[model samples]
Target: MADALTRDGIKYMIARLLENANEAVEESKENKDDAYCAGRKVAYYEMLDILKTELDIRDQDLKEFGLDIDLENKIA
Candidate 1:
């Protein structure tokens, strides 16, 4: 099996991907075709799909990256 990536890495990239998606939307604004707008939307959805599949392969859930899992555990 390949090395397992923690949820943190996944989340970080997801955020970055979202930023990219927003940029794509801005670029799409100039395009007149509804098809281009639809395609741009699909790009974000595709990124989410890739992220989910990668997480499944790594056996990592989003909850695991609570971002402060350690802090929460310590507070408890």
Candidate 2:
């Protein structure tokens, strides 16, 4: 079996997926297909939810490692 994904790996996957989704949206725009564009938008939101979950997991891991920094406030 393959190894399980770490937080960073999950993050990288999410970024790539989002990039693909963006490309799909652009293609749909050029082709003037509303259905395709709508599908891509749905996929984008689903990926966003997955990213949010991964971020929460990472935050938990950080706290476990005694690195309890407020990422939301600190990062931006």
Candidate 3:
């Protein structure tokens, strides 16, 4: 089996995913494209759900790394 992720590693992964999602959201708004925007929105929410569910990282764990469990607030 693959090795478990370190706290730092998990934090980094979550941060990167969030950043990508935020960027996609911003691009969709700026471009004002419907089709691709829909896809980007789906990808962003899917990633957010994975972070909340599949990773199962606790709120305190995120706080320890100066992150927040409130991902919707993090979205741009």
> Root-mean-square deviation of each candidate, in angstroms?
10.2, 7.7, 3.3
**TM, every model:** 0.48, 0.53, 0.64
- Residue 65's C-alpha lDDT in candidate 1? 37
Candidate 3 lDDT by residue in tens digits, 1-76: 9989798887787778777887877877787768787588667767777667644454355455434466665552
lDDT of 2 by residue, 1-76 (tens): 9998886675566567656766766666677658767676566656555556565676655343322443233221
Stretches of candidate 1 exceeding 4 Å from the true structure: 34-37, 49-76
Ranking by TM-score: 3, 2, 1
Model 1 Cα lDDT, one tens digit per residue, 1-76: 9878765676777667666666666666667477877587567757655665665677776454332223212211
Candidate 1, poorest ten consecutive residues by summed lDDT: 67-76
Tell me, by TM-score, which candidate is best: 3
Give the clashing residue pairs of candidate 3, or none.
none
Clashes of each: 0, 0, 0
